[model samples]
Target: MKLFNFHTHNKSENYGIINIYPEENILFGKKYSCGLHPWHYSENYETALSQIELLAKEEKIIAVGETGFDPKSPVNIDMQSKIFVKHIEISEKYNLPLIIHCVKHYNELVKIKSQLKPENIWILHGFNGKIDIAKKLVEQGLYFSLSENILKDIKKADSLLEIIPTDTIFFETDDKDYNIETIYKFVAEKYSMTLSDLVKYIEINLKIMGI
Candidate 1:
């Protein structure tokens, strides 16, 4: 059975979804998601919007983002919010799920979500925060995408795995040079589940989300 990587910057040999660069138009015949990240914000919003609008409709493009607020970024938050709103509109229009990239601006992100009231399923990629914050976000109907960073400390990862809902859990390597199998093994052990079972769970989850 193959692993289902919810968000990866580079294409994987295993069965998983990867992210397509916004500057590129081709889909490359693989499962992927496309969106303009907040850190890459440019003055030319119209150009970015056009590119996203055109590429997001592809059958292979399963989700609508890696876009969201980034408090540490030098780019203006207002600018990031504007682009993020555009992504939400496109995602909702296409009926695709959203893969978010949030930093220290969780509150602002939630505020935008409440205001927009979008229907697309939203998953925050690379989550490595406190369980309290995770609980708050999960309560708000947000999904969590665990990354290799979480594996840096097995005890902490086990603790988080015990708390985060299995149904809401997903995993990814993002841009890291790490093995998804390693992630699966660790998580499966924590949950006392077989690796294949964990892979199947993610597959079912993605299918349910219409990815």
Candidate 2:
């Protein structure tokens, strides 16, 4: 039963899509997802955006982002949306899934999704938002990758796991240093499923993402 991590920041991990900044060098032979994070947006962002598009052509580059809106970021929402749309274009051109990092911008994200109507899968990574928001994103055809928050509040996680369709769910460590198996164990117990069965369902979800 191999554990699959849909997103992670730990580059040492052998199993998962490792998140990389556009300025970082690609570690050959490892699967990665690259983009210019909203928080990292700068004056020379066009250079970084071009780099991401170029990386998108690589076979090991499996996804387009960890890019999305962050209300707290110095970059304005409009600027963030502009960059996000560029990432969406890269995802579509490469026919790869998009790994999103949204912070208090679900409404904007949903609105963008509605406007763009992208065919590539958009996965919201490190989700710990309200259940209603989760349901709303689910309605918009967005998938989710639950992370360390699940370990912090098992009860809330239980409610979320129950509502999220298994086929649209994935487990990840993100930038956390914990074992991904812990998340899988808790979710399996909640759903009354064996670890292997949980893995099988996640595999099916990955297939939907064209992994």
* Residue 42 miss distance in model 1 (angstroms): 2.5
Weakest ten-residue segment in model 2 by summed lDDT: 36-45
- Please give the RMSD of candidate 1 to the true structure: 1.7
lDDT of each: 0.81, 0.87
> Per-residue alpha-carbon lDDT of model 2 for 1-211, expressed as tens digits?
6899889889987878999987787777778999888889755588998888888875658999899988766788888888889889999998989989999998899999999999999999999999899889989989999986867877788889888888899999888788888999999988899999999999888877778
Model 1 scores worst on lDDT over the 10 consecutive residues at 11-20
Residues 74-174 of candidate 1 have per-residue lDDT tens digits of 57878888888889999999898989999888888889888888898899999987777777788788988998899888777877887787788899889
Off by over 4 Å in 1: 12-14, 25-28, 58-60
